[model samples]
Target: MKAKLGMSPIAWWNDDLVELSDDVSLEECLRQSRSAGFTGMEMGRRFPSDPEVMLPILKEADVTLCGGWFSGTLVNEELAANKDRIEPMIELFRAVGAPCIVYGEVGRSIQGDRSAPLAQKARLDDDEMKAYARKLTEFGEWCAERGMPLSYHHHMAAVVETEDELDAFMNHSGAGIPLLLDVGHLVFGGGDAMRAIDKYHARINHVHVKDLRLDVINGLDRTKQSFLDAVALGAFTVPGDGSLDFEPLVKRLAEHGYEGWFVVEAEQDPKANPPLKMAEVGYKELMRIMTAAGYTVETQGFPRG
Candidate 1:
């Protein structure tokens, strides 16, 4: 395994730098991210959206572009329209030399009706998933020509959320594609997060490390809201703040020879708690989790300005 640390310069709930409050400025985010010991970040929609615009700022901050998750209905949407969205994303990833772009599960939901089970509402459209998988294969091939990979995020909403769903989806898709195994997002479907990692060990290339609250998960299950909708409902946070046992999580990853960024993805009220303060807490938690798993790491804390 290569020696590298990964974290999301997650702007979703960053409490510092109001410029990143919505259209997160790269310059501002890089400063904060670098300060927090973040080696990289998941590019959001507002993150310059153009490599030409962000490349210089990234170099100045000495932060690598970890990659990003793109939101769109791949299985359900028309390929022509979907391509319009994917093409630019591919271009951006190419420019940054990112390994993959995290893509989501495809589904639609009713407004205010959050009582039905999500498993009932969200699912992988086999026929559609196959087509989209081929599209991704083509895209991956295109990226491969340039030495990149497509890490399709098997999100709770996407076709590959559950272990069973992932098994089936992988049977047909993901053969040549890499997958972003997000622990927090993966747990929503009640999937054994570690098992999923082991199953996709070969194809697993990137990660979005996060912790989840069982109470929050149960609450969202009661509402039956989609995964993205639940994000707005505050379902995720840094590992130690939640109930996940990251000890074995990291252990399992190590067993599989997993190497890459362990992107810290905590979408909480950063404004309520100062961003710098939250980062302090996050760094300690990551260290604790890593240590508990018996993995030794440099005792580095985010450099404070």
Candidate 2:
């Protein structure tokens, strides 16, 4: 199988926690990520929506627009409203030739609110999940028909936060709603990443290879601290520099014939853990794991000698 290496722009500049960001231009961000051996990058706030304006900057760095996040409100809103909101992003992703748009449910999410405790994350009973799943399926189908797919991201402080929530969502949702398997978030949310891979492998269309600092995760008082607080305490990191063992996960993914972009998406303070350096660590580790898993890593003019 073939796999591509991508990096998220959050490492350089966070959208939710602006204070954790590095003051850098979009060009510099792409250049640094490319220097770290990534051939693709997810869109960030600094990125211009106009493909005419964005494509050249990406081409200059020899980087592909792999994927990007979209804060969705499908949990409480109607499908029509969600459609209206996603239209522009769908057009942008289609123009950019991105694989998928990472759709994270933020209708009842407290991820951005540092004041809200982690335990206060939104919850959905089975009946509520059933309705939300139906809406998500319709939305995902709509996005896919438009030539841009939607990969549902089960986030840290969203409605579908824990393993049980994910199971509920997946059990109710159809094949139309594809999954974005964020290993770090799954692990941090007290979910078994391996079990999730085993169960949801067929639905997983994209991957986020974010590593976590277990010490920080364990130390966090979920009742008092919020998701952003945990982030501020250094709960996430790049692979090979943190607690995750990607070899098994990559091997499992390869075993299931999973192929596509494996993105490095650890969100941390750029000043404390420098995006470029952390990206390098993530890229190298993914390279090793992908090789061991018999994956041919795609090179979009990267690792140049």
Pairing residues by index, what is the TM-score of model 2? Answer: 0.98
Error of 2 at 74 (Å): 0.7
Model 2 alpha-carbon miss at residue 236, Å: 0.6
- lDDT per residue as tens, model 1, 167-271: 666666655667778788677777888788778888878877777767777876534565545655557777666788777877788778776667777766555
- Expressed as tens digits, the lDDT of each residue in 1-305 for candidate 2 is 99999999999998888889999999999999898889999989999999899888888898999999988998888888889988999998888789999998889999999999999887888799999998899889988999998999999999998999999999999999999999999999999999999999999999999999999999989999999999988899889999999899989999998999999998899999998899888888889899999999988732233
* TM-scores for candidates 1 onward, in order: 0.80, 0.98
Residue-pair clashes per prediction, in order, are 4, 0
Residue pairs clashing in model 1 are: 6-261, 7-263, 105-158, 114-223
Models, CA RMSD each:
4.7, 2.0
Badly placed stretches (over 4 Å) of model 1 are 9-25, 78-81, 106-120, 125-135, 221-229, 291-305
lDDT of each: 0.64, 0.91
